[model samples]
Target: MQRYPMTPAGHLALEEELKHLKTVERPRITQAIAEAREHGDLKENAEYHAAREQQGLSEARIRDIEAKLGGAQVIDVATLPKDGRVVFGVTVVIENIDTEEQQRYTIVGEDEADFKINKISINSPIARGLIGKSEGDEAKIQTPRGEVEYEIVEVIYGE
Candidate 1:
């Protein structure tokens, strides 16, 4: 099976979610199903149907988390070489070549990417352009709008 590249923080986050799903959600859904079963006939019990559907969804999420965790190759940024090159689990500061607008983003796995937090997926166009590039290097990315060029201002590891 193909292994997934992920930061240690992302791995921990996934593990925590899996724990919550299996420990809290699984038991809670089981109890709801049981309670709904006691309410009335199985044929037309809305509560029972809802509970079952919820159970199915919860179980599916649990399985998905488990699979992701199992396939994960956790990389701790702190252990990286800190060679000033952009890579997974590192924060890269870049400036738009044309607009001169500066921005900071952390290169992360797909599941760990949150634009609000300035974390972009490794597969993103910007990250793909930035990867293997050191500070002071210029990267050209193909975006939906068009090709955008960025100058790498800095590369920080373990941030």
Candidate 2:
């Protein structure tokens, strides 16, 4: 399987989620299933069916998380040299050339991408355009809304 890049923080988050699913959620679902089965008449039991469905979903999620963790290659941005260039796990500040809007985004793994948090996937178009670029460099990205230009203003790593 191809290894996926992930920030150290992202890897920790995934590990925490996996632990919760395994230790808490899994036991809760198992208890629910046992209680539902005690209701009797499994053929027409809605509660039992629902519990089983929930168990299936929980198990599937656990498997998915495990797979992601197994394929993850955690990168600690803090240890990286201060190159003043945009790289994976680095937070980049940019200015839109047209609207003159300023924004910050942390380039992260796909699974950790959250637009609301200003954390973008490294594979995303904007991150792709900014990768390996230094501050003061201009990047042109193609979006569904059309082509847009942005000038890199800063690159920050750690906390």
**Top of the candidates by TM-score:** 1
lDDT of 1 by residue, 51-129 (tens): 9999999999988888888899898889889899998999999999999999999999988999998999998888999
lDDT of each: 0.92, 0.93
Can you tell me which runs of candidate 2 are displaced by over 4 Å? none
lDDT of 2 by residue, 36-104 (tens): 889999999998899899999999999988998999989889989988999899999999999999999
Q: What are the clashing pairs of model 1?
A: none
Residue 150, candidate 2: how far off, in angstroms?
A: 0.6
- Quote the positional error of residue 80 for candidate 1 in Å: 1.6
TM-scores, in order shown? 0.94, 0.94
Q: Top lDDT: which candidate number?
A: 2
